[model samples]
Target: MATQNPPVADIETAQISSQTAQAGSTTGSWANGAFQKLKSNLVFRSKWAELNGAMGDLGTFIPIILALTLARDLNLGTTLIFVGIYNFITGAIYGVPMPVQPMKSIAAEALSDTNFGVPEIMAAGILTGGILLVLGVTGLMQLAYRLIPLSVVRGIQLAQGLSFALTAVKYVKQKQNLPKSKALGDRPWFGLDGLVLAIVCLCFIVIVNGAGENLRRGCGAAREGSDQRDEDGDVEGRKSKTARVRKIIFSLPSAFIIFVLGVVLAFIRRPKVVHEIKFGPSSMEVVKISRHQWKRGFIKGTIPQLPLSILNSVIAVVKLSSDLFPGKEFTATSLSVTVGLMNLVGTWFGAMPCCHGAGGLAGQYKFGGRSGACVALLGVAKFVLGLVLGSSLAHILNQFPVGLLGVLLLFAGIELAMAARDMNTLEDAFVTLMVTAISLVGSSAALGFLCGMIIFVILSLRGWTKDKPFSTIWTDRSTPEQP
Candidate 1:
């Protein structure tokens, strides 16, 4: 009997596996070989760009962490330690600025209830992690990745980015009686992280980001239609005044600067933070879970996060990674396995449950992170903080300006939404838009995903009414135009 060819998706998966194995086999130790591969790659450059990019996801990261630590009494030191290791490992393997973030649904449920403590959080993480591991190990994640339409993925990205932008705008805009906010509406506009400082920070980040893109475009344009000799010539005019200005701007590391300023302001606001700081690591222990706690955690946290994790964490992250770094490809199975392993290993010690996020990836890319070094640098910082200040780091983070985070989140959100720009067809665009609208209005990505899949199936069946086969309808939209 003639053997049938495995599907294209299968072939792609096989290629990824082979490449990784080849890379790992190069050295005596697999770990060393992977690191050696990363060392030889230019995309892993550690520079000011990495510094700026490292802070890109912090806008979303800090708030959720603060909420988890301050609200639920989770072991902050242990969380950072594991997340730090995860960052470096993810950066090393992926060769891009992959992000590890707290599960939003889990964070929300954990924060809203006073009764939801560390044990429940750990239970939820274990359950979610176990399911993801099974999905990845059994190859079900790869199958799901192939089946989900690209339009639906774009919709998820667009909706998430817009939602973040909206939330950021709210953070910028001050309201009376909201003392928990970083900036007060009643304060002097020019005083301490109020509207004026927020606007200034926003302007600086926008200018740096815009100027860098312009310089890159100019260089690309100069290289176009050039002879071999001309191409060899310095296209970016190293000595030019304009080039110097662009270099200086990029070197400023706006996100890092903003973050440091926030920390300073936090210290100023709460001088007692210095005295309260204990110079040691927080103890790590497996949170004891009751049978009731497991059920409650699963129902309250895992169930809400399951669809979000499936759609955003695994599928969307894989899709977005490919789009952002065309030279690099990521597998949904790999991402699922990593996320699953992260929570299973860490949450036992009361660490926050984490996963890959598209919004975080977009944020890093927007902030000049073209390489894995950006995340690795961030990992180093987290590692140091965990070892030194530990949970006391939360003291400063608690007072970290909400307005600043809002500014950062605003840009990250917009950046994530821009990933949907590749949509070239009307029906596909409409489907993406409708899904985004439903997600934002209904306040649920799962709803958007369910509706998107249903709408996609219905729209896809249009050709079937004319006696078209299912494969024709599937293939027509399955191979979307690449940007």
Candidate 2:
């Protein structure tokens, strides 16, 4: 009987080991198969430039989306899926590196509270979207676009751009208010995501940007060398070698590399995050928005969001797209229609409310996003992450190095701000600067917009064109000898 008991125990242990090994093998095989399929399909599929371009807007997207996810106002997976679909659809339709960003005003309002009342956010989004859709379909958006001065639009862009830059700087300096994440509030200068690391990343980006110019120069130099070879039969030497090296370096995706490095660092810092990941997507639910929530959402979130979306999202984005892609005709109506539809469908399911933004567009374009493929691929990545990782991404994102993000955000901000450079005239500059200043000072885009409109109206009424002097408003004969 004792010998039989020993055999039974041994058999049970063996059975347990076999089951564990089989389970492990099944998971390993599934992962290997997926990776193999992906690699096979990507042989001729994803271009390095497009892949690089795909990460361009992530600096802006990550912080906002992460904040919302942390606050529980937005579901990480649902938001990603919705925004991902939006990106893909827009990419296919617009064929440009179009941007879809969280509605900043609503996000701000929601994030101001502790829990952010998801229903309120949804209500605000639905209302705002409905209004935008009405305006777009009826051509009222076009009318609004025509009414707003270019200077005012540029002002909003300048403000948003500069604001992004300032926030990014804070993120880099590690002085941002986030005391919970990676000693950021302490402003550490020596550790991972420290000031030193940030500076290095910034320098790398500069070199990468300069490398493109160098490549151009190198190509020209190579051509010259070719010509010289043809003329004098001289062989190319150091310059050609340098050009090839620079090309190789630039071929390495700058944004993606840094981003991946940050993510890797995060995982290294917290290995147990692997165990936290669940296999399935987060559960999606229909949020219950009460009448009270709707009213509150309207008053707090919608009112503020409406002006920002109308001006920045629709008007400024249209202006920017035209300027950036001169041949592309992006209309305010189309933009409004898209924004309206995005929220109308997604927010009810607790997805983040989103809109177009000039800053995001400029940032993406400034990086490497020349075509829709950049964002389309980005969208696919987002959808996969959503379906696979779900809210587990929150922990990873929460751990991502803020300093690296800051460097990305800084460049994006500068790129967006550069768009305002075309307004070189005095009156236009005055309007743009004032709008930006007031917006930053008041912390209110609506207020700054009002101030900008007032200034523009006064200037327009006073005949404040380049040739018209301020003193000439009352005088039939104004002084013009100063030039």
Candidate 3:
């Protein structure tokens, strides 16, 4: 027996081998599970998903891209690559058609201020990202969400929707005026080429939405049918499925088709003499920050955005995610962290400050994006465009008719506002209306939140508010005195 126990080292070697095998098995099992989950979640069955996902942030993207490239002279390639990478990561992590949008306050201020440049924008982004990262990591984002009333959040969404719709109308009018331009020459409807396309796209959207509702009703009716009518129920269900498939196949690609047509028309009118696009790695510029730049960024850029980020980006987006995709528990912490990380990484590369947006979420969800594949597809497109087109992206996008973009924006805005339809109580309606009014007038979500809070405080003090947590003086009068 002593001889059989040749060496203790041999026993240890066998044990190590066994443990290694177990670990490998466990890792393989996990990998398989993750692969299966991803497969189930990634849906690219329809063309509309890709189109909607790309268009989700066009409202903000168009302006920001132009501002940075045309005005600030930032490297367009680096900006797009940053956006693309972040978008892909967001979609992969969330497994939903979530959005990565430019920070509106930062973008707007950066574009408008002659003094503000890439350095200032980067500083602002870094500052905002640090603030949000701390908030998310420490769990203060959830606290902020709890402190605000739902009605106030709804009001913000409403105000944003109205603003987007108004912007869409302006775009439509601009396209309408294209006919009068001498460059295009005199044509019918003043050469309002994009208007017709916009109308067609709008009609397609309405039809698809209507069909979705009908399919739901048909399924319900079929389920309610008697066992004896099983055959008829099966026939009805099949019809609905066929109709849905047809709608998906035909309507989903309308946006891309229209975009392509616009590009073609653009080339015909003014052809690109250059035969080839230069392909190269994107440029990343170093941000040079000064004390004055830091102060300006903090005051003009980061401070104003703090309220909106809390309300719209975190709270409102979380609510929309739950409403649109039930069973998904989207928390403020996750969203805040995502926004912070996006900006922190993107700004260093001279990308625009980016964050998750409620409007973008609504737009993506409305246009048939059930899973992350929509966003991933868009990310791939953007990444390729950055690599291939780079600076020429402006020319390509410019060729896209503004009127079509308007139609998409209008629908997205409607989807956002429609979310507030559930606020039926009289008090909630009043609060929402007050907040919307203030936001519309001020053109600032932060101002609206403050005004709403003040009004709520006043109403609470007078015992006129619905949410009364404190005991009134009159109620205390009826209580017995303490010993």
Candidate 4:
């Protein structure tokens, strides 16, 4: 039966080839698509989105904490101006869109137990920014990052997380007290009350988690069946599912609802402490500094902090390169040049020293931000918040019960810290921990970086580790003995 080759064989071969081609095309498309999406979505388009999202999440809370800590000690108006100017300059220049609202730690330093006013701190930030700009321009910043190792960075992150967590706990305890001064002229501690509130909040979070799980399961089941349909239909179905998920995750309405609930809870509790906190004005006078003060601010701010800022910038470039280009050598010197230039541009207008803000970047990625658009959206939103809130937003935050703010901040800090867990290797873990520790312990991020680098070098030299260098590494290994 010389029935030549069966027609089925030909068809089978053709199908196999088609499948291979389809797979190759899909993989290529996905790679291109993810990159394109990242560039356009988060970095470019979502600047305003990130800004607004962060503001709604914890941007507002950060400033308020600073205000409360410094209210009795500093000129609220002056502090507001300082923060506003710094934020404006940084946002305009570095394109890193993080909210540089006043930090609680800075406020604590300036307030001291004794009376030292906002002017000093404002002076400090201005000085820091100026120094950072100069260093960045001069290329000192790059050197700093190169010196630090991955282990130190990890440590720093871990320490920072702990500090943030402790801060949250302190605030929660403070929130429980009655507004009235105690017999000893000290504020009453509300530790017990805070614990209860924390529990309740946790319960609420749990409920939300359950609801989310149910929603995901339902959606997945729907998608699985829908994919069996015609090609066009499946595509449309997938789009619909994506949109639904996004709506659930980033919907302003949902946030508003939570906010409203918070407000209602506040009213019902009528926490007395809210009334005691001094609030800043909704508007602030823009003080034009005399050239002498400006010069002083620049000198004082930039000179001391310049070293740290540069190091931070270098670390940022290294981290970004590793993430964006795995298994590829990235030039730390080039990254330093780019960041330094950006910092210089930012400091011209009194902006905060801008760096990679690894924590912020990670959060954006987790939240589905992909491109520059996402980052840009964040910037726009921050600008708008600054404009709309003017100065009063800081005050409004102070008026909220401390417990409420504490809970919110606690979650945010945890989220930021959790990013460290993503670093799989021991060396990476060490870097994060060291960076965090240095930032917290020294209260100087730059110093922490320096310490981290020393550790990394020691580990590397011992041959206990193997990781690519940010710049380049040359090694002399004894030639293997001839076999």
For each candidate in the order shown, give its overall lDDT on alpha carbons.
0.82, 0.80, 0.71, 0.46
- The TM-score, computed over Cα atoms with residue i paired to residue i, of candidate 4 is 0.57
Which parts of model 3 have CA positions greater than 4 angstroms off? Answer: 1-31, 45-53, 175-188, 192-197, 210-251, 273-277, 456-483
Q: What is the per-residue lDDT of model 2 for residues 1-483, given as tens digits with 9 covering 90 to 100?
A: 355456888999999999999999999999998666444333322376667767778888898888778765468999888899999888766777888888888887777765457899899999999999999999999999999899988888999999999888888886553322323365677776678888998888776654232232221123333334444542533345555565566556678788998999889778888888776688999999888899999999899899899988899889988987786788899999999999899998989889988888877776667667678788889999999988889888878888888888888888888778889799999999999999999988889999999999988776745556666555645545554
TM-score, candidate 2, is 0.82
Instruction: Note each model's CA RMSD in angstroms.
Output: 10.9, 17.1, 5.7, 14.8
lDDT: worst 10-residue window of model 1: 217-226
Tens-digit lDDT track for model 4 on 1-483?
A: 676766998989999999999999999999997666444333433333333233333423343434443353333333334344444443333334333433333344433423323333345454554555455556665565555555565555555546556666666655422112112232243432345655565455433222222222221122222234433666544556654554444323222233445555554554564454444333443334555654554454444445444443345535543653254344455444444444444333323333344444433332323334434444444455555544444434444455555555554455455545667887677666766766787877667766777767776765543554533344324345467
In candidate 3 the C-alpha lDDT for residue 97 amounts to 82
Candidate with maximal TM-score? 1
Better of 1 and 2 by TM-score: 1
TM-score of 3: 0.81
Q: Pick the candidate with the highest lDDT.
A: 1
Error of 4 at 139 (Å): 2.4
Clashing pairs in 2: none
